[model samples]
Target chain A: MATVSLKNLTKRYGNMEIVHGIDLEIADREFIALVGPSGCGKSTTLRMIAGLEDISGGEIDIGGRKVNDLPPRSRNISMVFQSYALYPHMTVRENLGFSLKIAGATKDEMDRRVAEASAILGLDELLERRPSQLSGGQRQRVAMGRAIVRDPDVFLFDEPLSNLDAKLRTQMRTEIKKLHAKVKSTVIYVTHDQVEAMTLADRIVIMRSGYIEQVGTPDEVFSRPATRFVAGFIGSPPMNLHEATVSDGRLVFSAGDSLPLPGQFKSRTSTGDKVVFGIRPDDFYPTGHGLSSGGETEVHRVELPVSITEPLGNETLVFAEFNGTDWVSRMLNPKPLKAGDRIGMSFDLSRAHLFSAETGKSLRN
Target chain B: MKGFKPSAPFLLLLPAIVVLAAVVVLPLILSLYSSFTPFRLTRPETFYVFVGFRNYLSILSNADFWWAFGRTVLLLTIALNLEMLLGLGLAMLVEKATRGQRILRTLMMFPMMFSPILVGFQFKFMFNDNIGLVNNALQSLGITQDAIPWLIEGHLAFIAIAIAEIWSSTSIFAILILAGLLAMPKEPIEAARVDGCTPWQTFRYVTWPFVMPFAYIAMTIRSLDVARAYDIVKIMTDGGPAGRTELLWTLVGRTAYSDARMGLANAMAYFSILLSIAFTVYFYNKLAAARAQIGAEW
Candidate 1:
């Protein structure tokens, strides 16, 4: 295991810069996920760290040794590409043992390590099969197994699960987490799926437009996003952001709706100040509907007509008219409220977030 | 009459069949019939005289005919291998080129665009004993005082013809191999690099194997084309200088036209088919095997 650090790392193609000057430290045996949408430079950063892409202007240190000048083979790192880049001509066993073979390991040792990796990945029965003979999930397992056979200091995965079906992706996500625990190697995984980042990584690095938007644990990033993009991107059903103005101790919306300002931002907001208010679906529930908000939690109750309801087994998602837009709210317990039925909805102000509309920066400490 | 109309599909194919019979099948049958007779182009009435297997037997006993057959096969084997190597190198270099790739690809095909006759004549002058470019360059460089007889010497003429044939046909290998390289999936190559394989090892294990089937296909095509070395050898050395550079085609063409011994030439031509067919079958089987190795059905 080793610590990988990037100092002032920048990547530019001609005049167009893809990864701006960015610095990051990945601790030993830690799993860090670089998560973002497409073209966000997350993959570029991972490729640079793997030595597949040259660094334009900075240094990468692996195990306290600078590696910017080294080729991928000399870097002692393994990568699993999104295409599951298994050799089509090789059997699963040969694919698993390729790195070992290239490193000049004895045949017996190579067989033993391949066997161990296959056993770990549950690929014993499929060892003799070619990649074209296996299913997508099986090929992905072979790709990962190839990386594991080498036991390199770092494992880099570039959206390795993107090619699998949703069910297989979920299964492989857990397999990767378990694999990280068993291998204990420093890992950098890139993905556009926020749920994967939230579930698998020890820390998540959210990127946008060549800049690191935020870096924190999943819970921290989810509960307290640093930017509006992160706030909109991190949650399922997404956070509802409404533009409003601070007017006489209340948030006044353009659509003739108003709510009392949360107490935490009292010193940060003044009258006529424009803000983007963010609230999660789970934060809004029916008053006296399910679990209490807790005695210490302040809840502001207001009556609103429901517009739509999506029923799951345990909870129902309720969408209602708020500030001339349909704001999604969660309804716990059974509620017989139709689309036009009015019910008292609880607003958990302590959990709300406010950002400056002009800067898109959160106004929280 | 309406219900008895000719079958449309058969009607549509009648013209093709007629043209094929007129242009292809008739000549083939005529040639087969002539091989059994003591026929000459100048003696049309001799076509009716059948001397079954006599021409074939006499030619089989002829040592010069056997030598020409053996030499043709040897030239093909050597030239095909060399061209494959040179073509693979050229394709790899072209694939790595970043700018002006279209122009490079176009220029690589210039040799293929020229007729083999032109190539042969061009090389003939280049290999002339006294006024040749090679001898002049050698003389100017003070390497040798004597004018090298590139076309007059036995081995030198063989090498000169081989060089002309290879240069004209090497592009067949390059274009086919380049198609394979273009269609290759890039993931496995990058994976190999990450797996600690050097560039040479990557090419050896990944790129070369993936392109093997294409090379085999090109080999099969070129083997058939190069088996009959007529126009080029006819133009360059005309199988002269003690007939040191004689190939099967040059020998048969001379016997058919100059000697007017059509029966013997046709017998030799039929026998020569075995050599090219043997090469084609071998390469085709290898091509199938290589494709199967990559798990490609087509």
Candidate 2:
């Protein structure tokens, strides 16, 4: 039973403070991901929880026991490094059984645990090979197998799939999810890839500049981002965010083009209020090629010139010129479009977002 | 037949081959020939008298020669092992220094930069029985009332020579091992800690294996450099009172120069060269095995 908690957790390196006081609580058997851009303190927070880095101004509780001063081994946690840190001198069997050997487990117990982990990771045939002899994917598997053999209360993964090729990364992502299900241990996975966090995690914690921007399930973070940063960060082809001023009933962009203020922020905003407008590529599409079925209210249409089109197999991303910015819009069902062609683009206002220009916070309640 | 013209590659290599034959091969063949003769430097005309196996057979039966041979092997074995251990310890300490690492590494190699002859003199003075720093310090600290005969007694003089040799060469091992430590990735150590290893266990299982190849490389180099200690032993004890610290090279030097028995000296020199070859081959094999373990991982 491992429920990790960080209260007012802070990290400081001499005169510089990289990670400010942040709080998070993780439940038992829950798979959570802490994801952000580089230098956003995501990996640092994970290492702090792993007992690798010292916390400057807070307490860490792992399995209901305060582990602030405890060493990493006593914290009952295992971490798979970004580079699979397999012992090159040892064979796969020895690598898997090293922790058990150090723990003074009997030969039979060590072999049994090693065999179980190897079987789970499909590393049966490669047991006698050294880490130098294994391929990248196989090495990653051995690293995970080593972690599993220890049976720690918590599993910490620091970008375990980032080194793999795209196809292999996808395959390993599924394998990690399966491993988590079978192991049923509390896993805190850290990565910059939002897709990995979205597909694998039960909850996603998006961080920005040492602060957690939002924490929600995949659907919630995607559909209802809490901040403008999250809205732009969580999607591929990214959400189109434009800065504008609220004048009368319309949000007036700097390029003199205007979009109707999203309906949800009507009560939360007023005239002359500087704000940023946001809409996902899915919400802003070619007029007839949108995903929203019929009966959608507050749909604004404008005839705009298609700047570019990126055809991605089934659907294409249409870049339309709006407010002097090339806004990304999705086109469905293979609409034959070209550059400089005028297209009727639709902005689903009901699904749009408005954020305060000052704080970059969402204006919706 | 066409004119026999040398190829460009062979022409380019001619100078090197000529220099090698003149400088290296000629002397080696001459010495080998001399070892089989009963030639004396004083009796120059006796060089033509080849008394086959006389020098070799006499040295084989001489118990003094055998004792010198065995003592030389024992000294090298003990000195090399102690240097490796101390060098490993020193490297680990220097590697742990967070700041001033470059300065520490340079300071660690100060002993290695000193010439072996100079080191022998320095240690000889320090270990002198009557007026030496070691006995003086011991007497000042009230540890001993007598001036210990550091370079006089047989075992004590041997210890003195080993100390001088280790001091002059241990940095070779330390520098190489330190390079290994610096090039090591920090991830494996962190992984080891998380894998429930104590600090000692992490060092034993991870750090040592990673640096083993470097240590073995240093061992191979120093083993082949056994001649460097010859000057040190010659300066400090010179085979001692009653030949207590007599090594093969010391005996060889005395026979060739003092006794003018060039043929016998050449035979003794050949035997010592064989010892160096055996050590080099052994260490080279250990180095290859160590490299096989972790070389590809890097």
Candidate 3:
């Protein structure tokens, strides 16, 4: 296991720069996930670390040794591709032992390593079968096993679960997490699925347009996003933002209604300044009870027309329109609320996020 | 039922079937029937006289016919194998070239575009003993004082024909193998590199196996083509000085047209069909096996 660091890494395809000056320090034995949308350079970043791509500018140090000039074979990193690129002609056992055999490992050592990896991956029974004879999940296991037998300093996975079905993806996700915990090897995984990032990563690095948006623990990024982009990207049914202005010591919406500002942020901004207020869906509840139940602080209230109610068995999602913007709220025991029904909702302003209107930066920063 | 009518597909295929019968089926039946008779082109009535495989018996025992048969086999083996090897090497080299690859591929196909008869004439003139450019150049450079009998000697004549054959057909192998290289999945190669395979090791384990079926396919095609080769050899050596390079077609030509023995020639043609069938079946089975190994539905 080793720490992997990228120092001012920049990737350019001719004049267009894809990944512009990214610096990341991944500690030893940490599971870091690079997550982003398509064409966001997350996969490119991982490929650069694996030495599959040339480092246009920057240094990649694996275990404190710069690997920028090394080839992928000499870098001693194993990668599991998105397509589960198992050798079609070789059997599962041969596929698993291929790296070691090429590296001039002894026959006994190769056999032992292949046996151990197969047992760990539950692939002992299918060792004699070729890649064409295996199922999708089995092929994925073989791909992983091929990497496992190499025992490289770092493991790189490029959307390894994307090809599996939903149930299989979830199953393999947990298996990968457990495998990481068991092996305690430094692993760098890349995927576009935020849920996978949330569930699998020790530290999640959110990327957009080839730039790192935010890097933090999943909860840290979820509760305290660095910017409006991070705030909107981290959660399911993302955060809602509405246009508002500070007028006469009160936050006034475009509809001309006044709402109370939190005490900590009240002294930060002056009157006549335009700002946006952000709130998560699960932060709201059916009103009449104040924002605070025990010792928690109370905040503001808004009355709006309920647009739609979605019942998800345990909880309900309530959609409401306020200040000409649609907002979704998570409620407990929501009872058949129909469209055009007036409902008073309460919000805890202490947990609310505020952003500048001009630059989408967080106001608290 | 009163309002039903037939479809247009049958009507569209009726003309093709009629054309096929007239062009292919009729000639095949006529030749098969003539194989059983003592047919002569000059005396047309002799075609009806039943010979009961006497022509086949004579050719089967004739030293000249068996010698020609052996020579044809040897030519096919050497020419086809050499073409495959050279083609495979050229395709691999071209595939690695990042720049001007398109132009290179187009240039590689230039030899295939030339008519075989034209190629034969060109090489025959180049290898001619007294007035050929090759001998003149060698004599000018003081390499040899006398003109060599390039088309008369047994081994040299065979080598000359093989060289012509190779130059003409090597492009077929290269084009087919190039297609295989282009269609191959790049992921496996990347994975192999990450798995610590050296360049040669990667080629041996991954690239070669992926392209074998293509090579075999090219081989089968070229084998059938060379087995029936006539135009080029007919122009260059004309089965030559002592019939040293006599292939099946050259022998059959002498029998049917020059010797005016149509029945014997027909018998020879029928026997040679076995060579084509054997090669076709062999290659077909190999192609099937390759597709099965790769788990592809052909």
Winner by TM-score? 2
Ranking by TM-score: 2, 1, 3
User: How well does each candidate superpose onto the true structure, as a TM-score?
Assistant: 0.95, 0.97, 0.90
Model 2 ranges off by over 4 Å: B1-12
Instruction: Report the error of model 1 at residue A16, Å.
Output: 1.0
**Taking the tens digit of each residue's C-alpha lDDT, what string does model 1 give over B1-298?**
6688788999999999999999999998889889899899999999999999999999889998998998899889989999999999999999999998899999999998888889888999999998899899999999999999999998999999889988998888998999999999998999999999999999999999899999999999989987987888989999988888889999999899999989888989999998889989999999998998888767
lDDT string for model 3 (B112-199, tens) is 9999999999989988998888788999999999998888787788788989999999999999999889888888899998988888
DockQ scores for all the models shown?
0.81, 0.81, 0.70
lDDT of 3 at A2: 90
Residues A154-178 of candidate 1 have per-residue lDDT tens digits of 9999999999999999999999999
Give stretches of model 3 more than 4 Å off.
A246-258, A271-274, A288-295, B1-26, B36-38, B43-51, B93-105, B130-149
State the TM-score, rounded to 2 decimals, of chain A in model 3. Answer: 0.94
Which of the predicted structures, 2 or 3, would earn the higher DockQ when compared with the native? 2
